[model samples]
Every structure is written in C-alpha cells, then in structure tokens.
Target chain A: MADHQQKSDKTVHRHEALQKKLALKEERKHHNVSFIMMILLTLVAFYAISSDKIGDSFAVMFILVLAVVQVFFQLYIWMHLSHKGHEFPIWGMASGILIAAITVASLMGMIWTS
Target chain B: MSTHASHKKRTGLMDWLTTVDHKKIGILYLLSGGFFFLIGGLEAILMRIQLIKPENDFVSAEMFNQLLTMHGTTMIFLAAMPIIFAFMNAIVPLQIGARDVAFPYVNAVGFWLFFFGGVLLNMSWFLGGAPDAGWTAYAPLSTVSAGHGVDFYVLGLQIAGAGTLAGGINFLVTIINMRAPGMTFMRMPLFTWASFVTSGLILFAFPALTVGFFLLMFERVFGAHFFNADMGGNVLIWEHIFWIFGHPEVYILILPAFGIISEIVSTFSKKRLFGYSAMVFATVLIGFLGFMVWVHHMFTVGLGAVANSIFAVATMAIAIPTGVKIFNWIFTMWGGQIRFTAPMLFAVGFIPTFVMGGVTGVMLSVPAADYQYHDSYFVVAHFHYVIVGGLVLGLFAGLYYWYPRMFNRVLNDTLGKWNFWLFFIGFHLTFFPQHWLGLMGMPRRVFTYMSGQQLDTSNFVSTIGALLMGAGTIVLFINIIISASKKNIASADPWDGRTLEWAMPVPTPEYNFAQTPLVRGLDALYVEKTAGNGKMTPAEPVGEIHMPNGSILPFIMSVGMFISGFGFIYANWYAAGGGLGIVLITMFLRSVIDDHGYHIHKEEVEADIKGGRA
Candidate 1:
C-alpha cells in the first residue's frame, strides 16, 4: 500500500512538470515584448521621417538600421530561430542572403555604369 | 483499412492516378520524361535531315526555327529535369532511410503540375504554332511575335516552374529533417549531397525564370509593357533575368549527373570515393559560384569591358571546383578493383568527353573569344557535348546501376555495352564536327546553306551519327523489354552495393524499411558487409507502419491548372474562372478532410519478409 502511494505521488509530480513546460507563459511574455518593440520602432521611423529635426540621410540610415534590427527580432523571437536544432535552416538562410546581396550589388553596378 | 481492401485498391490504373508513393511517382516521371525525350529526339533528327545537305529544302526556315526552339525547350525543361527528378524520387528517400518525402501530398502535386504543364506546352504544336524566337525567348522578338506561340511558352513554363520549385523545397526539407539516426551530412551518399546542392540551386535560380516568365505573360496576355523598350522598358532586362536562371540551370542539370557518376564509379571500383570531404565542398562551391557567372552568356551584349571582365573571371573560377570533381573521379578509379560494368564504362567515358566540353567552355568564357564564338555552331557543339556527353551519359550509367533496384531485373550486359559504345561514338561524331563547322563560319539556327559552301561532308557525317544514336536508343528499348519478359529477378544487394537503398528488397515495400536503420558510417551497407553482417541493423523493433493515404486531388488540381492555362492563352474569362473554382474547391476539400492515413501492422511486414524469402 505504501509503495502504491509513492508511485501515485511520482506520477503527479511528473504531470505537474509537464504542465509547467507546456504552459509556455515565459515565451508568450517575450513574444509580447518583442511585438511592442516592433511597433515602437516603426513609429520612431515614421516620426524621424515626418519631423525635420534630423537630416534626410541620417533619417534614412536610422530607419534602415532599425529595419535590420526588426528583422533580427522577427527571425529570432517570433520565428523561434534562436531555439536549438535550427543550424541547417540558418545556414540555408545565410547562403540565400549572401547570394541575394551579390545579385543586388551586381545589378546596381550594371545600372550605375550604364 | 483492411489489408485485402488496400491490396485490391493498389493494383489498377486508377491507383496510379491517385497514388502518392514516391516510387510510383518516380515511374511516372520516367515514363513521361522518356516520352518527351523521344519527341525531342525526333525533332533533332528532322533538323539533322534538313541540314544533311547544303541548300536542302526538306523543311522551311520557319519550320526549322520552330523545331530548334522546341528541341531546346522540350529537352531541357521537359526531358532532362523530369528524368533527374525520377532518380531523385526513386533514390533519395530510400538512401536516407525515410518512409516518404517530407511532403507527400506536395510531391504528388509537383508531378501532376509538371505533367499537365508539359502537355499544355506540347499542345501548341497542334493548335497553331510552337514558340519560334528561340528557347531563350528574348524580349522584343517574343513580345512582338504574332500568334499564340510565345503565350504557350510563358504559361507552360510558369506552371512547370512552380512544380520544380515545389520539388526543390520538398527535397530541402526532406534532407534536413528526415535523415536516419547517425546519418550526418558527411555520411550522406554523394548523390544525395549533389541533390541537396541542386535543390538549393533550383530554389534560388528558378524564381528568376518565374519572374521573367511572369513579365512575358503580362506583356503577351495582359498587354503590359515590362519588356517594351518603346514604352521606356529595357530589353536587356529580359536577358539578365533569363541567364540569372539559365546559368545555374546548367549546374542544376550537371551536378546531379556528377552525383550519379560518383555513385557508379565508386560502386564499380569497389572503393569509397576519393577526397570525399573535398568532393562535398566542391559541390557546394560549384553551386555557390553558379550564380556569379550568368553574365558570361551576355558578353556580346556589350555589358562593357569592366562588366565583361568581371563576369569572365567569375566564369573561369567555376572551372576550379569542376576540375576538383573531375580529378576526384579519376582518383576514385585509380588502384581499385574496377569492374568495367555498363555503368562504369559510361562513367569512364564521361571523363574525357566532359573535359573536352569544359575546355571549350573555358575558351568561350574569354569575352574576346566569345565575340567569335557567339551564335555559332561552336556554342551548340559545346553545350551538346556537355549535355549529351556528361548529363546523358551519367543518366544512362545511373539507369544501368539502379535498374535492378527499380525493377527486379538486370539489364542484359552485352546489349548494354552495345548501347554504350554506339551512343558514345555517335555522340562524338555528331558534335565534334560542329566545332569545326562553327570555326568554318556556318551559323546556328539557319534552315539551309548554299551548295559547295564546304559544310556538306561534316553535315553528312553528323546526320549519320544522329542515326546511329537513334539506333542505340532502339537497342536500349529492346533490352528493357527483353529483361522484363525474361523475369531475371535481381538480388537485393546487386553489384555488392554500398548505400542504404540496396538494403531493401528487390520490389521495395511501401514503407521502404521494415524498421528504420541505424546508419553507423559512410557507405552504411558496405560497413556492415565488411563486419561480416550482410544486412543493416534495425534501429527500431518491427511495429505498425504509418503511411499517408493516396489521393486524387493532385491530379484534379493539375487538370484544373491546365484548363486555366488554356483559358489564359485563349482570353476566356469564364473558363479561367471555372478552372480556378475547381482548384479552390479541391483545395478547400483537402483542407477540411481529416486523413489520418492508414497503418501496416507488424504481422503484415513479417509476412512480406517471409514470403519474399520463400
């Protein structure tokens, strides 16, 4: 009878542990934070464009930097790319970016020279 | 599903239409690709006949243009790509020890789309006329060309390109996610490695073609002005986009051929591939560099000295990795117990032929020399040498090597040798003279030439060579028929195979592996053989096998797309609407349908094993 009671207790403990993992409340919190940050970044870009306080080139550069940051957040936080076991996909994406950069750069060169 | 019911359902023509088995789909690809290959070959022969004599009037100039265009389009898109897909489907899953591709439904969709798209493209010949502005289909000529020829090119390629893209994505995900336990990237067969890189190329390169075709479609069908220089659009844009896709496409075709040769050479030589890690690196490097060299094709377009120099340099840089591969193959054969099988013969022959093609390729890569070589028979000879000699030879070798795996029979060896020698000699005979012809000032894409222009003898020899090739193909067909009729069942490990694929039964089961294999090292099967165990160690106990159910939705979806393609070409809005409606409805049904699929019990698997042995 004592052994049966201990086994039942262990089962309950394992169930609670699984519940804790499945809740994912921490992940949800991080997602909310990232989402808000994205919106704020967008608003800042809008303000920089609308206000004349900054120079046009500075504003454009600022927005571009912000855009790059947003993309990181999107990939890492939203898409869970920061999580483990995504190395191959990350490699594929990086290669794609490299090729795209080359293509765009070449096209720009062609147009500029022409 | 009851075993008897499932068995009954799997036996008929209807099953083929609805089946989602990778092997079955592979057969479909082979059959369709073979059919189109014949059509393309016929076109080639007719062109040869026209050029057999100077000032020949066998075919008009207009018809000749159509034939050349169709020959290029059909062979590249319809024949070569699908045949590559055939081997990929038949082998990759088994090589990786996966039950099925990552997306079985999407795989079915891909095949059907390709089929319907090919049918739609060919339908142009019967309806009005085929596309005649060259398979390249440069902007102004394609845009201003009268009739619906270019329309078919635009729509057909659009649909087929979608299928190719889907297949590419499917392979990427499958390789990434579905490798067996202990099967690291380094442990993969060279064929799978090459395929992985090819898939990556397809993913990146095909989109350029898609965008180019979309622009053409809009110009031709919707009266858009994307390519209209008069409307302030650039004509060179089309050339840029086409080659961006076109250059990598050649790699996409050849890389898998390289993979096939690697497998065949290693198997026949009774040794592992030499410089295995370097081979992998070179394959990836080739794929990466493929994108940087598209401008080599456009050197004559006056991209200016700077652009031409950069592009030329980049193009020549590709030869490094390709040379690495070539040397690796030769080293693979060095000091090994070489069996000189039909497949090995092809592999050995491929080396010199591809090298010759590559030498010419580098010669043409020089921008100044390209000015002399552009739009000449030299360019034609160079490509045919690579395509026919490299890709086609590799394909035939792969067929001989894997025929026993695909079908439970061995192809007749003597006949196989005849097929090889005939095709090899014939291939050289047909194209070698063309190189001289190009230097002799005979232009390409022309229907006739004046008498006594010094082109007759070479052209005559080329025609005879083409006829010999035709005879060689006939011998292959007869060999296939005889092998099938004789029922010469092959052993499971025919050729003392090295890979995971040969571990399965002759007629591979639906689940492929009865239990998932535990891959211990490179050439997993060979490792076991050396260890005195001739079979793989199963990673899991025999259990119920879960399989995706076959569905006809993919076929219906393709038919619907075919109808919509016609609707677009003919400007029939209602037909378009109806076709799209059918597609959308089927998609909705598929979404709503909860097909958890069926399972094969462990008892059934046991029974199959026992019966096969019996």
Candidate 2:
C-alpha cells in the first residue's frame, strides 16, 4: 500500500514537470515586454510627426527610422522571428526587404530623373 | 478504418478532379502547359509564314498584331511558367525527402486556377479578337484600346497571377519546413536551391504585377483614370510597375533552368558541382540585382541619362553572378567523365547558347545601343536566345532527367538525341540571322516588309527553321507515345542519380518515402553510395502514414473564378455576382468542415515494402 502511494505521487510530479516544460514562461514575458515597447514606439512616432519642436526634415527622417525599428521589433520579437527554427524565414524576409528597398529606391531615382 | 476502400472506389475522372496528390497535379500542369506550348508554336509558325517573303500577304496587319500578342502571352504566362511549376511540383518534395508540399490542397487550387485562367484568356479568340497590344500591353495603348481584349488579358492574368503567388508561397513553406532530418540549407539539391530563390522572386515580384493588373482592370472596366492621362494619370507608372515585375519574371523562368543545368552537368559529369557555395550566393545575388535592373527596359522611354546609367550598371552587375554560374558549370565538367545523353546534350548546348543571349543582353543594356536595337529583331533574337535556349532547353533537360522517376520508363536515348540535334540546330538557324537582320534595319512586329530590303533571305531561313523545330516537336510527341505503350519499367536509380529522389521506388509510392530518410550530407544518396551502403538509413521506425483527404472544392472554386472572370470580361454583373457567391460559399464550406484525413496502417506499409521492388 505504501509503495502504491509513492508511485502515485511520482506520477503527479511528472505531470506537473511536463506542464512546466510546455508553458513557455520566459517567452510569454518577452512577448509582454515587446508589446509594451511596440506601443511606446507607436506613440513616439505619432509625437515625432505632430510635434512643433522638431523641424520638418528631421521629423520625416526620425519617423522613418522609428518606423523601421518598430518593424524589426514586430518581426523579431512579437512574431517569434528570433526564436529557434526560424532561420530560413528570416532569410526570406531579409531578401524580400532588400528587393523592396532596391525597387522603391530605383523608382524614386527614375522619378527624379524623369 | 475503411478509408482505404473508399479511396479505391474513387477511380476515373472524379479522382483527377479532386486529387491533391503532387504527382497528378504535376501531370496536369505538364499536359496543359504542353497544349499552350503547341498553340504558341503555331502562332510562331504563322508569324514566320507571314514573314517568309517580304509583303507575303499571308496575314493581315491586325491579325499579325493579335498573333504576336497572343503568342507572347501564352508562351510566357501559360506555357513556360506552368511547365516550370510542373517540374517543381514533381521533383522538389522528393528531392527534399518530403511526402507532399506544405499545403497540398492549396497546390491543387493553384493548378486549377492557372488552368481556368488560361482557358478564359484563350476564349477571347472565339468571343472576340485576342489582346492586340502585345503581351506587355503598355498603356495608353492598353487602357485606350477597344473591345474586350485587354479586359480578358487583365482578368485572366489576375487570376493566374494569384494562383502563381499561392504556388510560390507553398514552395517557400515546403522548402523551409519539410526537409528531412539533417538536410541543412547547404545540403539541399541545386534545383531546390534555385526553386527557393525563384519562389522568393515570385513572392516579391508578382505582387507588383497583381497591383498593376488591378489598376488596368479598374481603369479599363470602370474608367478609373489610373492610366488615363486625360484624367490626371501617369502612363509611366504602368511602365514602372510592369517592368518591376517583368525583369524578375524573366529570372524566375531562367533560375530553375540554371538549377536544372547544374543538376544535369553534375550528374552526367560524375562529379560534385564545383564552387557550390558560390553558385548559391550567385543565385541570390542575381535575384537581388534583378529588381534594380527593371529600368533598363525603360531607358528608351526617356527616363534620362542618370536613371539609365544606374539601371545599366545594375544590369551589368547581374552578369557577374551569372558569369560565376557559367564558370562553375564548366569547371564542374572540367576533368570529369562526361556522358552525352540527351539531357547532357541540351545542358552542353545551353552553355554557349545562353552565353550568346547573355552577351546580347549586355549589349542591349547600353543606353546608346538600345536606341538602335530596341523594337528590332535583335531584341527578339536576344530574348528567344534566353527564353528558348535557356529556359526551354532547361525544361527539356529536366524532363529527360526526371522522366524515369515520374513515369517508370526511360525515354529512348536515340530519339532523345534526334530531338536535341534538330531542335538545337533549328533554334540557332531561326534566331541567329535575326541579329544580322536587326543590324540590317528590319523592325519587329511588322506584318510585312518591302522585297529586296535585305530582310528576305533571313526571314526565309527563319521560316524554314521554324518548320524544322515543328518537326522536332512532332518527333518528341511520337517518342512519348511510343515509350508510354512499351511500359518499360525503370529501376529506381536511373542515371546513377546523386540525390535523395532516386532512392525512392520507381513509380514513386503515393506517400513518397515509406520511412522519412535521415539525410546525413549533401547528395545524401551519393554519400551513402560512397560509404558502400547503397541506401539511406531510415529516419524513423515503420509507422502509420497520415495522408490528407482529397477534396473537389479547389476545382469548384477555380470554376467559380473562371465564371466570374468571363462575367467581368463581358460586363455581366448578375453572372459575376452568382459566380462570386459560389466561390464564397465553397470557401465557407472548406472552413467549417472538419477533415481529419486518413492514415495508412503499418501493416499496409509492411505489405507494400514486401511486395514492391524499391
């Protein structure tokens, strides 16, 4: 009877251990932090565009830089791009950005030239 | 469960209509693409006949315009791209040691959409005239053109382009997620690597085309003024968007061809690809540079010197990576045993033919020279050299290489060689003189020319060459029919193949590998062979194989889109609404239905292993 009781206790402990492993506490914490940061970044972008203190050119540049940062945060943190098993996806996204940048930049150049 | 019996009951037409199997879908792509290819070839022959003698009076000017436009559209969008997709579907999963693509149902939907879209486009010929503004369909011409021709072009391409986008995403996810254990990115076959890059190009580049087509549709159908200069629209925007997609589209067609050549050359040479890492880097680099060079096509459009030069330099920059690939192919064969099989013959021929195309491409990139070459036979020759010599030859090579794997028979080598020599010589004969013709001052897209203008001899030669090419195609058809009737079963590893695909049984089992292979290195099968094992180590124990259930929704959805496409083209609102309703209702059914799929039990798998010679 004592041995049976001990086995039951061990089984319950293993179940709890498995749940803990599956829970992803650290990842959840990271997500929460990243969410707050994203919100803060959005507010800053709005302020940078609206504020009279900043000049026009600087405001444009600042907002653009901030927007890029927000995108990185959204992709790498919130979307779990920084996690394991995401290397190929990261490569895909990076190449996509590179193409998009080149396309837009050349279009701008063409517009300027024309 | 009795699911196996139910599956067996689904034989005949219903089986194909609802199949989610990659192999069947691949065959569908091949058949449809081949049909379009023949149509496109007929158009080419008719155009050649019209040009056989100056002022031949064979076809009218209007007819000639329609023929050229339809030929280019059908060949690029319908024929070449679908055929590429066919090979991709047939080989990539097997190459990567996966049972199916990441989304098998989506794959089916893509094929059906492409098929229906092609049908919608071709139906324009009977309903009215075909699109007459050339395949590029540049505005203000396209936007200002009369009739429902451009409308068909817009709607058909929109549906087909969406299908292509879905296919691209499917491949991207499949390659990223479905590789066998220990198959690293570096370990992937060259063809898969090329496919990966091509998918990236498709994902990024196709959206531009989609947006461009939508604007054209709205402008033409609803008078939206997106390209109507009379209502505050810039025509150059259309140019920008189209070439942005167009330049990359060419790469998307050619990159897989490059990959095929690499595979064939390496296999036939009995050597590993020299400078494999460099080849991968070059592919990515070329894909990257492809976007920047779009303006090269627009240099003669008055984009100005600075813009032209920038695009010119970017265009030339692509040649560096392409050159890297060319050298790597040559070096791969440098001191290795070379087999002269039909595929290898095409591969060997591709080197010089593609180089000629590439050289002319560079020459045309020069802004000053382009003024002379643009809209001339030189430009025509250049692209044919690339598209036909590079892409078409690559398709032929890939077909020969993988025919044994797909069907359980080898194509007759003697017939294959005849197909190769005749097509190769005919290709050169047809296009080679056109370069001189362009230099001699003959413009492209003309219905007729004055006799004794130095264009007669060349045009005559080109027509004869086209007939030769036609003969070659007939020979190929006869070969396929003869081979099919013979039912000469092939061994699994035909050609002493180097990749994991050859490890599977001939007439590859529906589940692909019975046990997911544990890939240990690049050319996994080659590695095992060298280690004296002659077979892959099984990655998992024998177990039940879970397979997705086939559904007819994809076909029905495509048919709905097809009906709507026609309705939109003809401006029939009620029909459009009905078609869209069907599509939405089908989509809803797909969402709510719970299809858990079925599994092949371990006992069945064991029986298969015992009964089949894998």
Candidate 3:
C-alpha cells in the first residue's frame, strides 16, 4: 500500500533497515540444526519398512506413533512454533490442539463403548 | 467521487473498496451486518405472525424451516458478532490510545470476507432455497437434505468462517502488540480485557467450526463417507464438533457485552467496577470452560449416565464464574450515586433478566432433568433470554454509550427509555411462558402444533408477545434515525465516560491521535479528569503516521469467494472451477503485485491533529 511516496527520510531508515537485515540473516543461521533434523525425520518416516508380513499391528502402531511425533516437529520447526518470533501464535495453536484432542478422544471412547 | 468521500486524500470508490482503515472497515461491517440483522428480525416477526392463530397457514413447513435457519444464522453470525466487532474496531484502538490496529490490512480482509460470505449465505434464498437445516446444521437430516440448501450452508459458512477466523487473529495481535506505552495489561480497561478474551475464544473456537464445515462439505460434495452410516461414519461426530464451536461461540458474543455493561454501570454510578479482578477472572474462566462442556448440548444423545453426569457437572461449573460477574456488576452500583442514563438502565435491567437465563441454564445442567427440557420450548426460552436480554441489551447499551463517539450526536434519552422498556417487557413476555409450554410436552422447531395438542393458547400468547417485541425493535430503529438527524451535538466525554476513547474529540481526527495519549493509570483518561488535568497527556511526540490506503483488492478478494460460494452451492462444476480460478488468481495477484503501503507524512499528520475531523 505504501508505494506512492519515494524519496526523503531515507538516511536514518536505511541504517536501521540494514541492521534488521543482518539480524535476520544471523537468526536464519542459528536455525540450521533444526531444519536438517526435520528433513532427516521425514526421510525416516517414508523409508522405514515393517517386518513380518502378517498381522503386525505393532508396526502400524509404531509408524502411527512416529507420524504423531513427526507432526509435532512439523508444528514446532516447520510451522515455526519453535521460533521465538511466533510465540503468541504457538501458545494459541497449542491450546486449540489440546481442546480438539480432548473432544475427539472422549467422543471416540464413547463410541467404542457403545 | 463516491458517496462517502469527495476528492479526498484517498479518492474513488476503489479506495473504500480496497481500504484497510479499521474505522472504515468497521463501518462496512456495520452496514452489512445491520442489513442482515434487520432481515433476521423481520424473519422473527414473520414466524410470530404465522403462529398468531390456531392452525395458522401463513407459511409452509419448508418455509418455516428456512426462516428459522436464516433468523438464527443471520442474528448470531451476521448481526450480533459483527455489530459488536464494529464498535471494537471503530473504538478499541482509539480507546487504548493507539493510532491503528497492528495488522491494518488483514483487518480489511476480515471485514470484506465476512461481508461477502454473509451475502453469499443469504443468496441461498435466490438459489432455490435457503439452508433449512437448523443453523446448527446437524447431520443425517442435512445429509438427506434435498436440494442445494445444505450446500449453501456448508460452503457459505466455510467462507464466512474463514473471514471470522482472520478477524480473530488480527484482534488478538492488535490487543497484544498495540497497547500504548504504560498501558499495562492489568491496567487496561475492562472492555479491552473482554475484547482480548473474546478474540482468544474466537481463535480457538472458530477453527473447530471451520473443520466441521469442511468435513460436512467433503461429505456432501465429494461423497466422502465422513457422516454416512453405511460407511461406518458416526453422525454424532457432527453434533459434537458443532457444539464444540457453538458453546464457546455464546461466550465469544457475550463477553464483550459483559465488558460494555461493566463500563456503563461504573460510569453512570460514579464508581469503578467494584470487583474488577473478580470480573476479569470470571471472564477468563468462562472463555476457558466454554470449551470443556459442548456435550451439555447433547444430554439426550444418550451419552450414558456416567458421561452425562460428568458433563452435567462441567456445565454447572460455568455458573460459578458467571455468578461472580453478576455479583460484581450489582455491587458496582450499590450505594453509589446512580444515574439512570439510558445505557445504565439497560445495564441494570440486564442483571435480573440474565439471572433468569442463568438459572434456567443451571436447571438444564441437571442431566436427568434436561431429558424433559431438551428440544422443547423451555430451551428456546432459555437461549432467547440469554441472547435478547444479555446480548441485545448490552448491544443497545453500547450503541447509546458510544453513539457520540461514533456519530458526534446523542441518542434521544426519552426515546431511548421507551425503547428499553418496550423491548424489555416484550422480550420477557415473548419467551418466558415457553417454559410452561415445554413442560407441557411441546417440542421445539415444530412448524405447528396440531389443532387439539393443547398447545394453542400458549402459542397464541407467545405470538402476541412476539408482536410486542417486534414493535419494540421498531421503536429502537426510529430512535436511532431521529437521534441521528435531530439530537444534540454531544461534546467529547458525552457520558462522562472513564475510558481513553472519550479523551478524543467528538468528531475524531482522521488520524486518531496527533500524539498517542499517555496512560498514567487505569481509566487513563478518567484519572486525568479527576486529578484535574483537563485532557490526556501525549505519550508520543508528533511524527509521520503510516496509514494503509484503501484498495479495491479486498472487495475483489471477497467477491471471488462469493462467486465460488455459488459455484459450490449449485454444484456447477464450471462455475465452481471458474470461481476457484478467480479467488486463487486474486490471492496470487495480491502477493506478486505488492504495493508498499502509503504513508501520512509528518506534515499531514500534524495538519490532521490540528483539524480533528474525518
């Protein structure tokens, strides 16, 4: 929306903008470890093979567990929940997930018994 | 030039169409929401007329369903939420002494989406039928629901729900990030605190609704087996999800009203809210507990005794917090120099009326007892009391409280008193006897009672009460127009209000504050008035103010969804495809063609501060 005016008030702003740019760059560098871990986790999720072709509900359970863990990582790292800049959104999202889990789980339990 | 502006700084219809100013967007919300509220109110009157006599034939069964659906959906979503939000957007930032909300552009997007979505939902009337499933849109019936009515319900809500969610996020960010310096969270006005919690509830609650809508959409449109009995999908899941959102949604609408009433009572009584901390705690607790107890809506769904018992307890738990709030408001006025200003009268009226609703709610919480009450006129009476007495009364109070700030004129007090009494008496009369009818075994949502059902007399009386209520609503609209045209030109602080918004001039500056007002204490502006500084201290020195230029893109974005909404509704493959194309293309254009927003230079800002007018 601000493309109308061009010149003036550039000197002080330029210095401030440059410092912000550098800080962003350094912050990106600090996040490289988490980025690699997320990729490695995704590869494991896709490649892991289940043993014993018959009735191994255990493997399905294990894979679903891994998928659940991977979802948390995606929420934190990929979805930027781990990033300090998004703390407010992170907590809000966590509250939503908690409530949703409770509703779905309790309903599922009711359906199972009935 | 367009109707609202001349060759103004931001000229052209395109300006407002695309604009991001929170105040302008607030006006749009009011305009759109107000129209739907009228339609909803009209629907209510029509339903009343149909029930006026024994075996009345005024409307067909299908039409009755449509009217009821539109009435509930429009009032709750289009009318009530947006109306309150209109005041919040128009006044909250100004109240907190901030120049603008944190995400001004997204704010515009939110309003446009809501506007367009609302329009699309109503379009169902023209598209053969409006959604006839109750506004709750439960499954089985909705799945078997003939025609494109259910499609409109699913897709229209999906679009509108997106808009509401976006607006929620924007408000949350704004309240968290944009408070003026020295305005600590605790020191914030109760209205701001209420808005903050309402926004938080919106953030969590609305998404569950969106998810439910999608599941419904996929089930209906793509033949997904999400709710199909033969496919092992449980229809009950839909009820659970809807109530999950529906229950919290009541709080989302009411909490703001609670905040407004608190402000009104304290200001009129010449005191602070007597138990401010308790009120705040209660507000937060309501917001939290709103999530835990969606099942209370479904006691008759045969959640066995164990499940029912647990939920019954949880439902009753809401009463503790609610009671604390009611007590606080009453105490706030006790022994004080009570001024029965129009707004204060409404606040005082609210206590007993809402207490009635709360008592019924607690009664409904008794799981065994609810079996008799559920799906009856009793439940109907219960909600109407809460909604009309609590929410509508609070909204009317706010309209009076902030009329001067909104339009630089005071509503006629005599007319306002008449409006209040007519509405109060009419509302109670309309819904009160519903308890008796329910106890007599009258099920709710039935188009008509059989001629010999023994239900005729009560229904007739209810219809008469409805007429009175309808008459009362008319008096309100008349008061508004007459006041707008002929009422006194109110000065700043028209009600001797104790909030930051009152510190601004009557016709506020286009730039809200020249320098943001400094906050030294709670009730920042009132503190200044009492300690005898005639006006607020400026928190910041004057400088350039960055105001987002209104653009037509938001309008286009909303129109895209509107088109897509019809596409989904009619099951027009080509229309659906084309509509998605338009919507996605607009979004892409918005991203790729970035316009670094316009700014009000230091000189312009100073000039605005000098001449405080829109």
Q: What TM value does model 3 have?
A: 0.91
By lDDT rank, best first, the candidates go: 1, 2, 3
> After superposing candidate 2, which stretches have Cα over 4 Å from the reference?
A1-73, A112-114, B1-9
User: What does fnat come to for each candidate?
Assistant: 0.55, 0.82, 0.45
Please name the candidate that would achieve the greatest DockQ relative to the true structure. 2
TM-score winner among the candidates? 1
What does candidate 1 score on TM? 0.95
Chain B alone: TM-score in each candidate? Answer: 0.98, 0.98, 0.96
CAPRI band of model 2? Answer: medium
Q: Give lDDT tens digits, candidate 1, residues A65-95.
A: 9999999999999888988898887998899
Q: Model 2 chain B — which ten-residue stretch has the worst lDDT?
A: B1-10
Q: All models: lDDT?
A: 0.91, 0.91, 0.83
Judged by whole-model lDDT over C-alpha atoms, candidate 2 comes out at 0.91
Least lDDT summed over 10 consecutive residues: which range in candidate 1 chain B? B1-10
* lDDT (Cα, tens digit) per residue for candidate 3, span B1-614: 11222224656676678667777777777778778888998898888888766667999999999999889998999899899888888888887778788888778878888888888888889879989989998898888899888888788778888888888888888888888888888788888899889999998899889989989988888789887889999898899889989999999999999999988998999888888888889999999999888899999998798888888888999999999999898898898899998888899999899999999999999988999999998999999989989999998898888878887888888888988888888888789888898999988887777778777887888888887877777887898789777746789877887888888776777678778778998888889989999788887787766555556666777787888788777678888888778878878877897565555667776766677532
Which residue pairs show collisions in model 1? none
DockQ for the candidate 1 complex? 0.61
Candidate 1, which segments miss by more than 4 Å at Cα?
A: A1-32, A51-62, B1-8
